[model samples]
Target: MGVGGNFWDLLKPYGHKEGFDFLRNKRVAVDLSFWIVQHENAIKTHVRKPHLRLTFFRTINLFSKFGAFPVFVVDGKPSPLKSQARTARYFRSSGIELASLPVPEEGASAERNSLFSTYVQECVELVQLLGMPVLKARGEAEALCAQLNSEGHVDACLTADSDAFLFGAKCIIKCFCPNSKEPFECYNMSDIEAGLGLKRRHLIAISLLVGNDHDMNGVRGIGLDTALHFVKAFSEDDILNRLCEIGKGNASQFQINIKSEDNIEMDGNSPHKKQLHCSFCGHPGSKRDHMKFSCGYCAKKDDDEGCLRKPEDFKCDCFSCGMNRRQKEQKRLENWHTKICQKIAEEPNFPKDEIIDMYLCNDNGYFSANDGPHTVWGKPNIEMLIDFLNFHQHWDPSYIRRMMFPMMSTIFLRDMASTPAESLLFGQYEFDSLERVKMRYGYQFYVVKWKRAGGNIAFKVPSKESGTQDVAVELDETVNLLDDCDVPEIHQDDECSFLLTDENMDLVGAAFPAEVKRFWQEQELKDLKKRKNSASKSQENESPASSSARSIQLNITEFYTSTKVKHQPKQEESSKNNDSGDSNMKRNESSSSNLPKSVRRRLLFD
Candidate 1:
């Protein structure tokens, strides 16, 4: 329904580099009506509604994964200018009489119209559920898309409508291929101007002359090349002036003059010879031409045999050409519809926000000991995401985790014990040295490891004193406590690490259990004892003469004990064991071996 008959040929040199991957991390505004219309064939053919929903769902899903945030713009109502076409189509499709057409306000009375409306509603719902915002345009969806692109709300407008160019979209994607193997077909306004040597107004003028949805019958015999020539030569206002001048004068004569100038022959037999030949090829025809009549337009220059031409080339003023064009257009429309439906059905709708909130919260402030619901933080949500991916796509959970987890904000891990350990283990340790501990704001925190919770480290801070000695702490007091305890590096690691480190010894000593506190105290005592013993030895070593004499006396005693033990051991054992004693011992061992193996082994080994 756009500027037909190879309108793209003039702008082919301006075609954009293909591929949708470039759209990653970009925001695009989609013409939802275009999509629905493009998928109309699928909707009509399918028995259930899921086929339609699947189309939208899959398309949005691909966009999301590719990091393209799409804003779907749906048509609100048919424009007044396009009302005739809409009414005709409605009546034609529904098999309803034109006289029986319902008024706009009364809603569609035809079954086909009602079904189409329902499908549109379902599409909107599907997109909404997929988390893409849906906007109802006051006029056409393409117009809205163009506006959004112009306003910089989106990077581009995705539509097949050539009218989108007239609507002032800077960038338009003519076709989207969801598969990575097939690239998208895009067009840039800049490229168009550069390649075609025409501006926006000139393009609009050409559309007006060539015929479009708004103007069904443009100046006949004025094709793309002729339209381009006329537009380029005259200003937009001057072109309109010329059209008006021609309209007031002999329109047929003007068309013939234009056609003759382009070397197109007029019908010689006709009155005034004003009627022109076929625009595709210069052939004058009458109503008598049959379906098999050959077109000189589609014929080869050297070939005189016209009847044997390709079936598609038989474009005479015959019933066959009319039927051929209709069939081709219908087929093209159906193919386009099927492509959009498949794209929508294959893409996924991942719950990005819900998944993020499940894993991480914005305000990660710690709750007091008496506070309800301890945040388990990222673990459960990460697991949930993994499980969801596994169940839905049968993807490896590890791969999903690898791809997803690093994208989450680290602040959510504030309550987790591993947050600190990871920081310290990775040489990012940031705790103040021990001597800084002091009682500030009459509240302190001790870093304690919770054994029951798989040894998770956390900060233990006292709550506000209620009548029963437990109440919510005042905000000011809590602020002061945080300020006094606030160690920059420690906080960066986690609150737990900040409290547990050496800087908060006074709090640790008071708040930790006796065993935990005693363990630190014992280590300190041992260190002190070692230092004192070393000092005592240094003092003793200060008297060199006394140390030397003690060393000599010790050497003499060691020599005497070594000689006596060496001489006594060899003869003493031999004298004590006579032959008879040896025989008696052997007999006793033999008798013991006769006992049960267990008793014998126990007696021998134990």
Candidate 2:
């Protein structure tokens, strides 16, 4: 979807795995359309309305798991060049023979937008309900995402598009992998520049030489490696300009530093002459001389008879041969570069100005430095979200809330951290107690219990002056249908009974420091008490028996050392059965006939 010729592979070396909290408290711009369409395309056949499902879960994970404030950007009007490229891509992927396939009419070419628009719209709606900000790009979604990042409106762009680098993204998260310990495959422009010496313009130039989303076929003969080699020859500032010049058949003026091995260069006046070599060893000197005094390469201990046999793909290593080889390679590359530049020159539009403009243009006015794109992450519309998912996904409100709890709790904890106070979680559940501390993936969390908030409590008192009963008037407990199946059951005499849930340890420490400290102190006391009790028990066992004159402590096993000795209980039972003239089986059968049918069935199963 970005630069072709396996551009991501070229950048793979620079990408690094980032932890779940890498984007904590940072604003990230997401290529909303690509995020949905690319993923849904993979599992769309097996998963129904995967876009909506993915969007829902992804938003929750990006927000709650990574703690990133995600701003989703949908595509506005795509550029005409992009439209043409997309059409071509669709045709190529349709599995139809291009020559046999009828040339378009609108009906012939399947528009990619038409296929994914409905789903993308549904995703956009779901994201909005989740309370993330959504923006429309002036052209491509990654363009706006990159703009937001470049302008410092967002900390990073969440996109897989390699062209996001060309579009001037400082940092990009390619995507998240659910199965990975470090989920985010993050790329920093600084790392790329430090490692590959490629800046934004250099990447743009590579995209021009290789290929990109908008320009599918770059230079006919050039690929990622060729583009990298060609791009490195020029400075970042003039890289794009050089590409334009090369596309105009002016590459001859561009000086290329093809470093010769050991700084060797052949002068026309001193052309490298082919050297004589030993036929057996493929090294310098005549074969006759080598047979008498072994060649340097062949003699390991200066006593070897024949030269070590040359390998199947061996080449002569003489100085003259190496020099000549370099000369030929230099000439070949010069010719190859010339041919590639000619191919660029032959193309209708060399370095497509629109694409260069698209990448370089920092502000498309839709998102700008003046009044930057809105990246504010708002409070989620819970009710709206419930209704939306219920209608589109057929998910029960209870299920939605359960799924939404992580995101909801995260937001709640943040508020509590800033203004420490007693509050209901999600305005429905109240914090009960901290159950225990749990660890996962090297992260500490507090297992906290939450119970349904009692609307029956927290009521205004009746006025005493009015002669009304002194008790405060109360409202009946609000029975919510959504919570009927999900709400924790309260047992007799226990007001706030509920299951424990894992809460971020850091958030809990900040929001409820006193409680956490108290919990630790109590745990320490309990552990100390346990240790003291065990120590006392051990001392009691080890101490001499009180008031015992001569107590014998004998080991029964030492007294009875014989192995394989059986007890006489079986023989005694046979004698008893013989005396009674009735078997134990008959007695059991009589008792079973009196027992219940259910018990008999249970016995059969047992």
Candidate 3:
């Protein structure tokens, strides 16, 4: 659909996956029609007017979650040359016949075209209501997207078109998948040039040779690989001109190898000459000599039948055979190159000047030197947005409000950053407190909670079952949304919390410096108090234990299962030798005689 040569595939290897934060604070040019068609294809199978739903949600996510200021570009008049390609594509996709009507509403293409264009208008309205800019292109939307990117009016172009590179786009997000952690297949032209060794003109040369949406019949025999090889031979400065020259039967000006077809023969005084081989033995020398006496290579004493006769598919691995094969391949390629050049010469106007001009020209009718369109973001009209979504999408007013809450909060924060004032969020809820910081994938967020002011609950309505009405004592932020999504849900509480992670730390710090300062101050003071208490407790526990100077220390000086020791007195007591040794002996003898029972007999025995 882009450039009929599978151009995106050629550039696929140079692409990288980028996270949502990659577009933070960047101005991106979006091919609005491309996104619409892509979404319609995916969702139209089941959902009614799927383009509406997809465009609505995807725009919200891109603006709020990705934090990008998007300029949506809608298509203008298509190139006259793309009519056939466009019609053919439609037929293939819809399985329609060639007999067609030119009137606006006569055919399937017409009906689809009318419906698609109407939806595109609706999307443009939605984008405007959402505060993003929309620009109409003079030619194709992608061309204008590329123009905006190349002119530095935008940081990147968001489109899946392969020809965006051909149109001089520096960087392109090949696709957008909002749910993925890394939601972009981003490609840079510098990487492609380095990886493929191909420049813009080289790409142009390739598209011109193989085909493009503008010219499906480029050359009869040219293909991607052959065209790639052909284009790389010439530098960018002369590639398009060389193509023009070849188109005008001036291919002889370019160097082409002279093609010759001849079979290999072992002849005298030739560079490729080799010794003749015995056909039956597959070795050096002639068969006649081998028949008379076994050749030296096949001369075996046990049994010799001249190398047991050559196998039917036997191939000689001699040096001459290798040289022969290389020469043949070289000649074949030369022949191929010659035929391709002839085909180029045969086509009338081989390189269409309009197609080349279409790609090479940088003026896309939307850019200017002094007065380009303003790239600044504007304030969204919430009332208008709710009405618009409700009318077109059949969505509830509550659902629309909840979905767009993120965008509104972002706008509010941005305003707070500029004004540096204490203001209610979206003029309805006031900042309650700063919840703890939450981090995901190495990015930090200020979890800020907000509470709706009393008597100002815009979300609260009359009770469903009340004859008159009941007092609204409390309010809940929860609501029933039309679709389940990753948009941060509002919990059932008077207060709601948000992970304000889209902004840089410096911006948020500038916006709410007092809150940030207070949080850090509290954290530091709390940490100090904890440390102080812990130190005091540790000291209190150590004081009583440290008061005692002597410690009853026990030591196990030996290793054994069990041991019994006789009781003994200390050294001080044992060393005391009484001076009255006779007295001590008489005391001990008297105590022993006083021991009872058969005292007389015991004394006699003793």
Candidate 4:
């Protein structure tokens, strides 16, 4: 379904080869989309959420064992317009959580929000374990990372999708299990452009014109080649104008036929002349209107209609059941966006330029238009906010707490039941639960500053420092001392003098809460006692089955092709069963027909 399978296809020959284990040792920044797809909780849909199925511990262990590093980046909520487009796509495909209401009465649909939140936590923990930085940018983090690379922040971006190409990444290396024999494929931007016959910038434009399956459905008739032609031939204004015109002629049968035919021949030429009917209206098309259908028969009355017979009009198959669904959804999102924008406006210390700079506008996508005064006094002095809670070190609980209070107050306003920390507590019902929300929304004090500078600033601030400093400080403050030295009774000859200055050990001690300390002490005693225990009992404990590998029973109720699919059954006896059931292995190859025609043609021919 992606990159004409050129990416996966390239790795096939190298699978089972030596040196592939190097992948585990390499630093790979996993994108949010990949995580969504691996999740077992969510039902499969046309637009896959890659956050599912990924085990936080397994990923961490994989990276740790191989001496590799991984940075997991979560995609932020998209623009209101983009989100609306996403919701509509889910509605059409019947595979997303768009059906859930703000207040649900009952069923799994209602549980989707909880499930989604839980899965995000799992993803965050996996990323956290690797000690790699995670970013929560407004758009896709892979794209943001690409932006970072352009500014020379990192060596390269590691992801699975070709869409990263659209974000201007100079290089993209496909990620695979280090244990797998597959050779990691590395694609350069210039090579990709040459192979695809489109420049890197044009890739974004083509993606926009053809539609991104993750965000929105591309125009039905536009394929890769046509989309490429579109970016080359038309300016941004021309593309928008074409969209408006095509929408107007949607009803004409001739136009729909032409588009349908265009979908078939992706090599840039058609055997038959392009039809002038609107696909949506089933009426005559107009070059002036770009064949968009407003009224089913309006375009037909024009001169173009004289050459063709009147097309029969049929009611939309799902119209009655779906009446006003689009409008209702649109209204809901518009209200949400307006409220958010207003809240941003009202924040006493809002940094307009920073927030504005967070998003980059291109012809491919339009960001929310800015309103309110472009200038405001100390209106949320970003620097003051930075200092009020020091960001020089790794972000700690208190820092998150303080930041949340102001951020929630500014964004949620009266809608929130309490302070950001309190409301989040209310939302999650626990303090530990704050990690995922923070991972997703927490402004890595560093990433935030980098974004604010819009590439004008340089210097990569280590996020780990911001995260660990307070714990280190607290530990240092709590250590017992007498005149800057340990008491004589406690300071035995064996007690190393170096322990007093070991900042890292002190920091670790500080990070351990009371119960944790007791548990560690007990574990140490257990180790001392282990040598005296009976050999038989130790043997029992050392059995392979007793290893502490977390086993998860994922009951995947997948809905596909109008049917439900469940994974291999789990029975007590099945614990020893190694039968790899073919029936349970349902990796449906998603059709890539929606991609650009040239790409499609390449796939079809390949």
Candidate 5:
């Protein structure tokens, strides 16, 4: 049998007994539920790392020295059906303002209490060293640990609570030893039964009648003594029959607690009956809509709450509504899309370039894309799309906000085709133009649209090989430049006042010496000169190149569309080729390193 708790301290009294040596090799399975619970709090307090070094990790080190191995099992999230009462208690204890629900503080007192239930890092390290598989039950981690013992995978279940008894583990070792104590006390289920003068079934019934500490609905007014009487006298059939009768008699009242006011036996056979069931499917699951409990099928089908079902006699996948439910989902999605489009339209800061591009081109690249049968990019708003990118370095959120403008509009239409017409349609723009723009804005080319007359179209295309490496570096350079510049304090419309401010224009002109700099500075000064004359609005000056040209550059080596091979001149055995006129002619025919000055400037900056 596995030995746990302060076994070392307890066994100290029974030292060196032959065969009792099995205690050393017992391979004790320690319940890590408390560890996880405590860890969540420790991590918040910044004591988790230290705790790992001292407690769990230290145990591993100590055990290794003695040639003993221990396995630790962590507690998982509370099961929906099993822990509803406990959850309700926690929620009540939190006393959080309803408003805090939307913006819960990171380390709120409630979270700290919950984290206290999470085991620290050392538990993780200890498990890794032991090479034991970590098991997670469908709903509760603790239940799985108890089940492991029940199934005989573990010699015995070790835990701080008595809940494991409900799972029917043969033996449980509670508080075996925390630090050090003699007799290293452990209470077997049989011993508990003997002490209480009740059978195992009676014990389970009492637990159920009283309600589990985690989640249970205690039959009101059914005290332990009254419950004990029924457990001793009634058979399973008798108890179930009475329960059904009582339930039916009160069916019209829409509640089941009246009969529960009279004490009766508790049974473990159907511990789940009192808990919440799927309203549509009648499945005995809790938190079906919370956190990780989402139904993948329902999510994939349509992300609406109505798709989740519960019925009294629920069976099979479809809820009571069946096909009608599906039809409703389709209508819901259409309505949702309309509202989303309207919201985007109202947001002034939304990238106009991206919006215009998506609207003009029949592609959903800025929002979503479908790549053949298996893959699909989910739709997202401009902020969501931009935030999806992984940044290499810390960046100001505002700079990224600005670049998301034109970047959002550029759609990736379709995969490149070798045919001339197709190439001209999708791949006509120099790859450099595309790469430089994306690099500067931290955008992935989402998808391209087919230039159809109507309807949304999109195609996936991989970035071209030649310009791929430069994208990251160029983007980083642009970010660095933006970081150095002083951000304009005024809004986009107050451009004239901002430009005329000597301090502001000094910074702006130094960053970009192009057309934008000249226009803003010249107008700012001119408008300020004559207070008597009406404020003259200068004609809108257009920059020959778009705003993107501020950071764009071209590589000369990539100017050629295709590679042309030239034969290498064979070296002469003698000094003849070195001295020969033909060799000189071949050398002169090769490409030149230096280009015309205007050509060099154009390639570098144009």
Candidate 6:
């Protein structure tokens, strides 16, 4: 399924840390297929229901609790080249003939594949419900996960597939030992390169030679050890040429049995004739035309006899064409060669820059990197997650809150304020000094005056409202002089009592002059009272009007209910009036009819 066992043997074991500790505050990209396959036996049931839902739920929950943000990547459509291996595995596992399997229609849905069963769908749904992202890859999920990690979209990839290394994954967490006290197994790219003495290119080459889903059985007689040796011995360019030569030599060994009716005879006299056989059309000829190797059958004009027109026209009785067996084999070999060439020539097709841009862009919604209170990683959506765990998972809200507070504060403060650590001490007034303080609704707010600019700035001791007490204590410890400041306790309505100082005033070395502090304190109290009185008056004016409207509606409803008198007389009087009006209109029409046509027209005009 991946690189052979010998390749894995070369990988050195990285030292362990507890799974929770190692993954804490990390963004991990998970290969969904690997997870599903790893838990296949435990999750699958006879009734076709996946019992693994709970396992997946608990696994993701554990990651979240440890502060690991996981992005689940599911496999999309399988590569066309992988179909043979998939089909072979299906036949072996299901014990059904490959012919019995439904042929994949053109543009068939990716979900129609056997690998993505209802159980996998259920797992994907569970991940989505947990507010985690599930990215459906364009091709292989492992490749996508590797890309995500390599590009810094995630800190590491969680995949057992060894091929992820070849895909350029910097770090791989092979498996999660959630129940074990020890940390999970992980591999680093640096370690892999050092231990194996192979770069990414070499790893890919080894996989191809050792046999993979794309190239089954690899080169005959070549095993993992031989492949490793070959890769180490040859440069990338040299390895590709060597592989091509080996493929051509192997193809030449197959004897071409020409049919009597085809008039193509094997020339035993010519040494090169045996090697010139057209592996497709069975036409033997010279191996070189104009110093280029040319398959005569493929080069033949359409009008020429025995020239293969379409892929379907290759049907013949020759050894290469019997039931299309050799045709399929030939195609497979060509595909392998093409892929090898591409790997050697081109870079890995990963949208690394695009993914980085997406993460760095400040966007609102799920999967946004900058969605939290600060731009630092893992701070966004934390509150929503804490709430979810507290209510749904029945976790103690206080415990969860306590666990996240310090981590969040450290990252938030590091990002939000770039104030140097030394400057945090009030005793060191090189840049700024604590000018004034006010306590409002259990929060201690202070004003800092920058000495150089004489600019005043306000700051709260505890930034977050929920954990004010702890943050306040931490602030006091950080700035010991805060305890000496005479902070006045003010009511809730007096929150904005701190005033901006004069722009030109210079108090570079003065430590909160008593006279200036007293002046601001008196002015702050007067402003607070004024604001409170105006706020009360606005509320009182709004409340009386609303109350009067409610009373008027109630009175109207009561009057209507009490006055239910009969309306028969009103209906009778209205009917009589209608009859009189109709009679009067008829009399007017009779009077107009008696007049002359011109006179009636003039009267109507008048």
Candidate 4 residue-wise lDDT, 202-279, digit = tens: 555455444553335444444565455445544433433343343444212222111111233122122334345444
- Per lDDT, the best of the predicted structures is 2
lDDT of 3 at 591: 81
Worst-scoring 10-residue span by lDDT in model 6: 476-485
Candidate 6 per-residue lDDT over residues 3-106, each given as its tens digit:
66455566745423343356655788877667665644542432123323333333434343343667778776665445655665668688887667666665
| Superposed model 5: Cα runs more than 4 Å off | 1-22, 38-51, 58-69, 75-77, 95-122, 130-132, 177-183, 197-200, 213-217, 236-606
Could you say which candidate leads in TM-score?
Answer: 2
Q: Candidate 6: where are CA atoms >4 Å away? A: 5-7, 12-19, 43-52, 93-115, 178-181, 236-238, 245-606
* CA error at residue 391 for candidate 1, angstroms: 20
Candidate 3 positional error at 125, Å: 0.9
Query: Residue 4's C-alpha lDDT in candidate 2?
Result: 92
Score residue 233 of candidate 4 by CA lDDT.
40
Worst 10 residues of 3 by lDDT: 474-483
Off by over 4 Å in 2: 41-48, 96-115, 263-329, 455-495, 545-606
lDDT of candidate 2? 0.73
- Candidate 1, 409-519: lDDT as tens digits: 112123122333323211222323232333322323233221112222332322233121111212222111101212112232443333222212332343333544566
Which ten residues in a row are the worst by lDDT in model 5? Answer: 431-440
- Model 1 ranges with Cα > 4 A deviation: 40-47, 88-112, 178-182, 236-606
- Worst 10-residue lDDT window for candidate 2 reads 479-488
- TM values, all candidates: 0.40, 0.74, 0.70, 0.34, 0.32, 0.41
| Pairwise lDDT winner, candidates 3 and 4 | 3
Candidate 2 on 1-606: residue-level lDDT in tens? 799999888889999988756788889888887667555544455434667766777788677766788898888776667776776777789976555634444423233556578888888888988888899877778888887888788999988888888888899988665544576789999999999998888898888878888878887877788889777877888878877887777878865656565776544335556878878778888888887777787776655466676788998776787778888877776777677677778877788897898888876546446666666677889999988876776665665676777777788888889997777777778766788887744567687776666542222223445433211222123211111111222322254346455677888788778888999999999999999999998887767773131233234454355333544676667657674335666677888999999999999899
Error of 2 at 360 (Å): 1.1
